[model samples]
Target chain A: MITIALPKGALLSDSIELFKRLGLDFTAFLDSKNRQLQITDPTNTAKGLLVRATDVPVYVEYGQAQLGIVGYDLLLEKTPDVAHLADLNFGGCRMSVAVPKTSPYQTPTELPPNGKVASKFVNCAKTYFQQLDLPVEIIPLYGSVELGPITGMSEAIVDLVSTGRTLKENGLVEVDTLFQSTARLIAHPLSYRLNLDNLNDLGEQIKNSVSKS
Target chain B: MITIALPKGALLSDSIELFKRLGLDFTAFLDSKNRQLQITDPTNTAKGLLVRATDVPVYVEYGQAQLGIVGYDLLLEKTPDVAHLADLNFGGCRMSVAVPKTSPYQTPTELPPNGKVASKFVNCAKTYFQQLDLPVEIIPLYGSVELGPITGMSEAIVDLVSTGRTLKENGLVEVDTLFQSTARLIAHPLSYRLNLDNLNDLGEQIKNSVSKS
Candidate 1:
């Protein structure tokens, strides 16, 4: 039996829908009141575990769940040991560098030497600045990295830019895009090696469905 | 004028109540729909900046807000360069080491050498185990640390424990407490030094009200 971990909130519906197209009946697992962390599918050949989006890769890497769906931003941030099977192409966003709209530091070079750049994705920010050969401080913030620049805590912020509404409202403007992100289907290395045929079939089905949609 | 950063959710009410006792009217700032991140009192002698609980210390440490009310757990995790003023004593919890209820490792030492301990507080967990003279792997998880042991990602977890219901439900048990935690008042170094008299007066008012309550 193959167990899959699905992120609970915004990504849940899309994951379930994708699985359904692959002939997997995951409806019972979607019941809001179930409250059960683990639920067995009607066929009992697969199980679903609801978890926080960021923890999806952790579960897959540990082999608790053979498969998972998570955002690419998380993959860049944590860099967990998991096989990046296929891009599901949903939950699209861009990881970008932002600064307060009123800041004098518009370009990356304009930033003061060794000025701090706050972000939830500390690793991503580090890599981005390193690629630019810029030595800057990365201040890790769990939420609202937009407020970092607005409050002068950091000269700039590296965070996900979706519709740009959040940054605009926070008086921040996107300055540089680090990466384009979407949800990806990931699997444990051991699981992929052992159940190659079944997992590949599942992966192929998801890719076909996603392309058609 | 004095600027204070208050956490947005559970701790907001208690923080406002504490400030009100000092004759600082902060009710208008408490409205959930205000959308304005910064709001001033009617008299303009003080202003409130509502921010995510986890970012409270960041604002204060950066001098964006002179003072902040935040959980002690965050303070331990971040170790910001801020004055640890009076312990507000609310939001009480413990940073605990937990493992599967059935795990054979009863004590921290009984666990396999070089075993992993997962937690959102990566730095805190690393420091705790390092002090125990254990060579343990620290897996940084953003949420659901209980799943670490259940999924075999880590032999144990270090996380915040309040009611222990979450752990119990996940078939995990607390093994040891790293530290006892509560909400605290933190201030930037320069702010405390510059506004020494006013800050002390505010701290005294809060301490008095806390004792009376």
Candidate 2:
């Protein structure tokens, strides 16, 4: 049996739709009343686990799910040992360094030495700043990265920005973008290599689905 | 003016109720239709910021909030430099190490050396294991830690166990508990030390509220 891990928020519907096109039905997740995190498709050939976007890689890395649909940003932040199967290409977003609009410093480098930068993606933020040779403290905030700047907890924040609505509403402006993110189909390395449960075939169908879409 | 950081989920209502008893009201948060993250008490003497439970310390530590209500577990995990003031005596839970029912290990020490232990509270788990002189890899998971054992991702999971319903339903059992957690009233170090915003007076009122309740 093949199991797939699907992210719960912005990428869920598109992920379900893509899987539906591949002949696996797990749309029960879209129902507002449905609270089940794990569900098996009607055919029983596959099952899906709805989890946080950040957990997709963990599930796939441990072979709990032979495959997972996750954002590329998480792939960067976590760098879990999973096969980068293919890009399914929906749920586009970007990770960027943002600061309060009123701040005098414009770019990451302009921020003061040893200043604090907050993010949920700590590793991603750390790497970005390190590459720039900026020695700043990366405070890991699990929620509301905007609060980092709004509350003066940090000089700036590195966060996922989509539509720029949340950032603008919070009076934060993007100073530098690290990368663009899109939905990605990832597989467990051993499962893909061993062709366990015909994952290679399902993986190929998913790749085809992306191309067709 | 004083700002208080109140947690957003299960503890929110209780935190507000406690504050109400102390003569400060931020009850707008309890309204089902309310969408605001930040609200001011009608009396205009204090403001409240509704944020993730883990973020309360960040707000208070940065002095954005003179006070905060948060779980004791977070204090152990984040170890943010904040003054531990009072325990409000509500929002009770426990930090525990849980394992799958079928797992061979019956206790933390029984688990194989260097086994991967998954937790959102990686620090707590690591500390507990280290104190036991057990060297294990602590994998940080952001959601539904029960999946750690169910998926064979880790030997066991250290997570918050409330009623233990989630763990029981997932076929896991708690092998040990790190500590019981209750919502604690914490203050910014400088704010509490300097009695800024008459924090000492407000602090005594909060302490009285808890005792009176």
Candidate 3:
């Protein structure tokens, strides 16, 4: 049997739908009343573990879940050891550098040297700034990255922007996008190489579903 | 006017009540209809910034907030350079090492060497194991730590246990406690030293309130 780790937030539904295409159903997680974190599909051919998006890759990397669905942004940040199986192409968003609308800085590079940039994605923020040869301090704020600028603790913030509503509501303007993100299917390396539980065939089927969509 | 950073979760109401003793009311944060993250107390003498518990020290350490209320657990984990003022004594909990109830390992040291211990408090976990001269891998999981044992990803989990309800419900038992945690009053070092906005007086009043209770 193959175990798949599904992230619990924004990408959950689409991830479930994609898995449903393979005739494995783990929709029980979508029910708000359900408190179970791990569920086995009715067919019993697969099991699903509902976890935080950041943790999906950890489970796959550790071989706790032979397969996992996670965001490309997490892949970039964590850089966990997992096989990149397919780009599921759903849950699209972009990682962007944003600053208070009133700030004079118009782009990421324009922010002053040694300025603080807050984000939950600290690694991504650090890498982006390093690529630009900008020496900005990345303040790791796990929640409310928008508050970084609002509280004047940071000159800018690096965060994922989906609909841009959050940025707009927070009075932040995207200065530069680091990368566009989409849901990705990742597999345990050894599992993929050995074709454990017909993993290769299932991956191909999911890839086909994504192309059709 | 002084800015006070208040944590948004379990410690919020108690923190607000403590501040009420100082005649600065931030109760607006408790109203279900309130969507504001930052609000001026009706007295206008101070402002409150509602933020994640982990970010409280970040705000205080950066001097974005002259003072903040946060859990000692976070203080220990983040080890941010903020002046530790008073132990509010409310919002009490404990950081414990928990494992599956059915597992044979009864104590932290009994667990096999190199066993994976999952926790959001990675630093605390590492410190505890290191002091014991036990080699263990700490897997950082930001959410749903109970799922660590359930998913068989880790041999144990280090987490904050309040009523022990979550651990009991998840079929886990606490084998060892690292430390007892309570909400603490903290301030930016410079702010505390310079007595900015009568910070020393406010800290004294808060300490008095805590002792009186």
Question: Which numbered prediction scores highest in DockQ against the true structure?
Answer: 3
Model 2 pairs whose backbones collide: none
In model 2, the runs with Cα more than 4 Å from the true position are B101-104, B114-116
Per-residue alpha-carbon lDDT of candidate 1 for residues A82-157, written as tens digits (9 for 90 to 100): 9998889888899999888888989877888779999988899999898888899998777777777766779999
Clashing pairs in 1: none
Report the error of model 2 at residue B84, Å.
Answer: 0.9
Whose DockQ is higher: candidate 1's or candidate 2's?
A: 2
Identify the superior model by lDDT, candidate 1 or candidate 3: 3
lDDT of 3: 0.94
lDDT of 2 by residue, B1-213 (tens): 999999999899999998887778999999999978888898888999989998899889888899999999999988999999999999999999999999999999998996999899988998899999999999788888887877677999999999999999999999999999999999999989999989999999999888888
Query: Comparing 1 and 2 by lDDT, which wins?
Result: 2
In terms of lDDT, the best-performing candidate is 3
Candidate 2 reaches a DockQ of: 0.67
Off by over 4 Å in 3: none
TM-score (all chains, Cα) for each model: 0.90, 0.92, 0.99
Ranking by TM-score: 3, 2, 1
Separate DockQ for every predicted complex: 0.62, 0.67, 0.85
